[model samples]
Target: MTSQRAPLEPLVPHPRAPVVPQASIIPPPPLPPPAPASGPAPPHVFGLEKSHLLKEALEKAGPVPSGREDVKRLLKLHKDRFRNDLQWILFCAELPSLIQEGPQCGLVALWMASTLLVPPDGVPLDRLLQVALERGYTAQGEMFSVADMGKLAQEVLGCHTELLCGGLGGPNRDYILQHIIAGHPLLVPYDEDFNHEPCQRRGHKAHWAVSAGVLLGVVAVPSLGYAEDPELAGLFHPVPSTPYQPPPLPEEGFSGAIYLLSKQGKSWHYQLWEYGQVQESNLQLTDFAPSRAMDGRAYVVPAGGVRSGLCGQALLLRQHDTSH
Candidate 1:
């Protein structure tokens, strides 16, 4: 055994080896330096202070009555054929009384209520205007001049005509209406002749026109649909009826204007306005391709021959191509 045995190997250990004693291997305890004290969390911040103020102001304003009971009774009294016409008359008659409170309070409620009462396919524009004027002016306690009244008539009629003829949507319809309302001064001719120069006028005629244009554009664009056919017949399906659901209302209220312009065909183009400015692209549309980056302000671009953009004053869609 002594002759066969090799030289014994040296027992070398690591330089940083732990010196273990013959004892139980218990784990070390965790260090407790500090405890977190509980307190109230920080307040949430919103970017738009002015918008908050506006919302607060609107909330302070009370509700506007739509004479729903009267409308229901009227509907019951009339046949289905005459219901639409009668409803318009009733609505118009009530508008003045509704708005007598003031534009900020009364007008807002009246508009919202009216919108809710009438479905997209409800009443005709002619009847709607007739009722609106009768109610709206009566509340104001003033008679529009013949010229002004004619202008209003033309505005309403023209919008209807366009819808029938050109198939214009809400924005186009509203734009035409606003222009008529603003263009027509007193029922008779006014000595000031504000209609001669609409841009220079101090009144809200121009503002209303611009605002209307914006709103109409927002509602009109055939977005949010997946139909293969260009005709928007099967675009929007009816929402399922539910007891918990409230009536349909315009999702985006009249904020400000948004302007949008984008290419259409090889030479054609389309322009859209919403909120308070012009929208440069219908991002909602399938064919649209957005080129401009979105800043805090509205977006605009050249389309066809139009130099389209928002100039704060209004969303301008000027014809730049003089070739035609």
Candidate 2:
């Protein structure tokens, strides 16, 4: 089933991104590139390390986290993978990290991830919303079931999704990473309420995070700036604004850097931080609007790390392999 109603704004798909075959996704065509040297370089160019001076500066730098020191480790992992700084900049630009709208975090994350394939718009948000409403997966806007969400991918986007219960520790958690390392993007759920508890799978109070690639002891989950960016703000609506922007540097870009989405008294802020580290406290989910749909629901609990799901309940999604 396709969504007959269109979004308020037209989605501008990334260049070379192809549409999914199953859904009635009608993403607008990619726009032309800007003129060369027309403006200042992006923040990521300075987020990486391109010189010996930076390496020395990073080593002597204290861990107070001036935001620049945070850049050192991320650069070490991906700097060698790309040919030049410009190429790395382009690669980072293509990565998706849209902000969440209410309890639509799961939907926004899955929708954000759909852009990874060849198409401007991946799976339309309306299509996912429509299917969820029809199939009762929406669960009062909680978008509660990962299994049902996976089915949405199969039915609407023609993707192959797998559910893995990777425990929260060594070895067991490795199972989830194995797929990401194998190039599968993951949609994981973890309760903000149980973030500090190492052994609970309570589906109540959860949020979805998208992981694109993992390697070198770090995972790439691009996020932040979607709702804040002036150009993209219209599409990522109803989101509070943030003034948290990275301090400008030189040419190197931040490869593994992650923007932590947290809330202030009234608005949300994007702190320049890493999500790779295990949590010590709860994330503020008041903005997402709590729905107790996942309460008392049966969910998967995999063995190994003994505390898996620390990265949230892991759900892997990929395009169907049609090469038969």
Best by lDDT: 2
lDDT by residue (235-278, candidate 1, tens digit) is 12112232221112233343322221111111111112232222
Per-model CA lDDT versus the true structure: 0.22, 0.39
Q: Candidate 1 at 285: error in angstroms?
A: 26
Weakest ten-residue segment in model 1 by summed lDDT: 184-193
Displacement of the residue 106 alpha carbon in candidate 1, Å: 23
Model 2 TM-score?
0.44
Q: Which residue runs of candidate 1 sit more than 4 Å off their true CA positions?
A: 1-50, 64-298, 302-324
Predicted candidate 2 versus true structure: per-residue lDDT over 1-324, tens digit per residue: 111211111222111211112223232222234437867532321111324554355456532232222233434454553223221111121233333434567776677667754245686666776776565454333444455567767677777666543232233244444444344566655544332221223434456656554322212112443232233211121123543222221211343332222211111111222334322111221122123323332222222211322233346676677210
By how many angstroms RMSD does model 1 differ from the true structure?
32.0
- List CA RMSD, all candidates: 32.0, 18.0
Q: TM-score: which candidate is best?
A: 2
